[model samples]
Target: MILSKRSLLATATAFALVLPAGWAIAKEQLDVVATTGMIGDAAREVGGDLVKVRALMGPGVDPHAYRQTRSDIVGMAKADLVLWHGLYLEAQMEDFLNELSESGNVVAVAESLPRNLLIGHEDYEGKFDPHVWMNPNLWSRVVLNVRDALIEVQPESEATFRANADAHLEELRELARYTTEVLSSVPAESRVLISAHDAFNYFGNAYGFEVMGIQGISTESEAGLQRIAEMVDTIVRRDIRAVFVESSVSDRNIRALIEGAAAEGHEVTIGGTLFSDAMGAAGTYEGTYLGMIDHNATVISRALGGDAPERGMSELLN
Candidate 1:
């Protein structure tokens, strides 16, 4: 039977609405753009062959003060979804990323965690620390966030995404176990960790180190002379032998720390570079999220007189 023209138009409209989302999912891979290496790693793992992932920040890149370039704006604009750390971690780029949510899916995975589980920022009123990845257990939540985001975009790949997330979560658990074992080996007295920035409060909470960064949590804040002097005095008094420099952060303040301690008759050396704001070189084991944390935990352990493999707990980090 021939349908009326109005009925045909209405039928076509309903079909168009119903089929476009599925057709798009089948025709194009999800394009996911992430702000930091950690979130980028998650998208890559969870999306697998179903998505194309680009990370805006890379090795030795500081997310705290990172500003999006023209290329970054283009990438985010073209992406199916955007992932970021949030919790003011990307302080400089927060406003832009926040505004993007009005038009598309923009997720702040670290900020998705329960408030009570997050540590309060000492000075950033009403904000919580954004370094939740320091603790593998805490990072597991982020992995699931990535999985859910990917599934939202392309539901057909749900099984693959879930499986990849589960495997990655297990790896995170293993990394945590290794971190605990190695860090626990450090003598309790030598467990105070000093660094250029206060990025490891979560690490200290998870692994029993007394953490101090020369600069505050956000690198945008300056390390005052008084703060440096106080840290130097603490190092001298405790004879803390190792201080870590972060790959993304400037080492000038770290040098000041060492010089200050030396003038006071204490010798403190940089233990090893840690991947705080970013991962290691791309295509290397340290470039991955697992490797970043592994490298940091191993470096901190071996630096402070603990026993751990030179390469890392897995002997695969580069």
Candidate 2:
């Protein structure tokens, strides 16, 4: 028999209320449900052997428009901890997650970041950009929050979580260093980044590039013909040679930009397919948060006439 989402949530809440006080302690590994691959990677890194993490959104999945399914609700309800990137990244899941938070161990990991460090959303007043994972230095703060969350749920594993988080943060620091070096190598005039969407604003801010996206911060927003014409004009006027596509967002707009440029007698090539709102396939290195950023930095640097190793930082990119 099938049940409605509301009914399932109600049932899940009632079941939780009946469980013993130390019910989670009975389980060997903490079951963690994360809204995105980035959060899931953090949970796995910090929780290590003590956690079994499930990322609701996988490779090529756009969180901006992703709504919670019945299975997602059930999994999040039963999870020992639910980590979501707040700041409206999960646009469709916010209401459901807020409802679940009242009865479950739900936390918006990205919301823990200081507002001063966040980029303001142009279309929405008082809303900040949700893609903090783009900057390693900023993401280090999110890693701390993940560590604190893990410690809050399982105090006994505080030492382990702290250790793992520190190790992971060190790797992020190295990534920041490598990205800085490579991205800085691009000529100042050639550092403009045009992509399928506004997901790279943080990356642009970090590396001093002028970023333009065909779509807004949210993929749900449509890109009109005038916007395409304006971008084509910008590309031709600036003599921009490359533009990028995202793994999750459709490359149709990018293709439009290319065609538009060609019509204007300017040639442009696809810089690379970047993992913007999503990571690579699950089993690949690019699937990890570290690998995702590494691949982006390497590809952008190389495509924009900067210096970056073909294999990316740590020589681990595939």
Candidate 3:
């Protein structure tokens, strides 16, 4: 059949218009960058298939002393939206986060929490401790902030993000209740939590445990001979049973405490490994924030004379 060039062009245009919107072109997925695994996990739950999320610090990496590499800088620069835990959690990356916020793509999730509710660092006047996520109830607020940020970045997907966030928040609440119930099995006198580092103040506050760390709040702080001596003295004097080692920091300091106690005829065993600064490997239950907390709660409860389930699952402890 013979056809004029103008008629052919018109037919092609009509066919293009009749195609599905997806066939026309798929929308570009939003690029999301989160500071840590916990934030990344929350973002993933909220974003689902609508966004690409990248966590700057992975499992077992400490954020307090984490220096951003060149790739991290580039990633932050390229990200469409960024979520970071503020309240001095990222002390080294503060400037970068503030710059990103000025550029209008960064959101500090912890900023949503009210100041009066936060625990203040003793040495740092007027600065609140940044470990708000230790409480799932407080963490829900951060998750909601992440959802709002995602909606702001891609308003069309607001409903999906909101729904996902609601579901995830419910899970967090349940986990919190579970943690409380599990911890209740421990006798009040035995509820002492000692670790190599003092990262669990918020956890202690939430769970009613007396927390003592060999090191200070920030891992960057040094553990001197006096600090070790003090902790060892406490261990011997109180006859404490178990001390924990954090995955991110070196266990040498903790081992020294144990040896010092042994010299004084006090026996202390490591309770179990705790995920303080980071999560477990991906795909493992410990990789998720809830799983990490559940593992710690179970291990701690059992080690401290509580009736928590062994192995944390159906199988025996590995």
In TM-score terms, which candidate is top? 2
Ranking the candidates on TM-score from highest down gives 2, 1, 3
Query: How do all models score by TM-score?
Result: 0.90, 0.92, 0.88
Positional deviation of residue 178's Cα in model 2 after best superposition, in angstroms: 0.7
In candidate 1, what are the lDDT values of residues 1-318, reduced to their tens digit? 233444434544555543323223333678788999899998888788788777889888889878887556655655689998899999888877776776678888888799978988865998988889899999899889989988887788889999988888888888888899999999998899888888999999999999998888888889889999898898898888889999999999999989999999889889999999899988998999998998999899999999989988667443
* Candidate 2 C-alpha lDDT tens digits along 1-318: 344557767867766645544334427899898999999999999999999888889999999999886567667778899999999999888888887787778899999788889999876788999988999999889889988999999999999999999999988988899899999999999999999989988898999999999999999889999999999999999999999999999999999999999999999999999998888999898999988998999999999999899989967443
Clashing pairs in 1: none
Report every candidate's CA lDDT: 0.84, 0.89, 0.81
User: Which has the better TM-score: candidate 1, or candidate 2?
Assistant: 2
Leading candidate by lDDT: 2
Instruction: Tell me the spans in candidate 2 whose CA falls farther than 4 Å from its real position.
Output: 1-8, 11-26, 316-318
- For model 3, the superposed segments whose C-alpha errors exceed 4 Å read 1-27, 313-318
Candidate 1 yields a Cα-based lDDT of 0.84
Over 4 Å off, model 1 = 1-27, 316-318
lDDT of 2 at 100: 76
Candidate 1's TM-score reads: 0.90
**Candidate 1 positional error at 105, Å:** 1.5
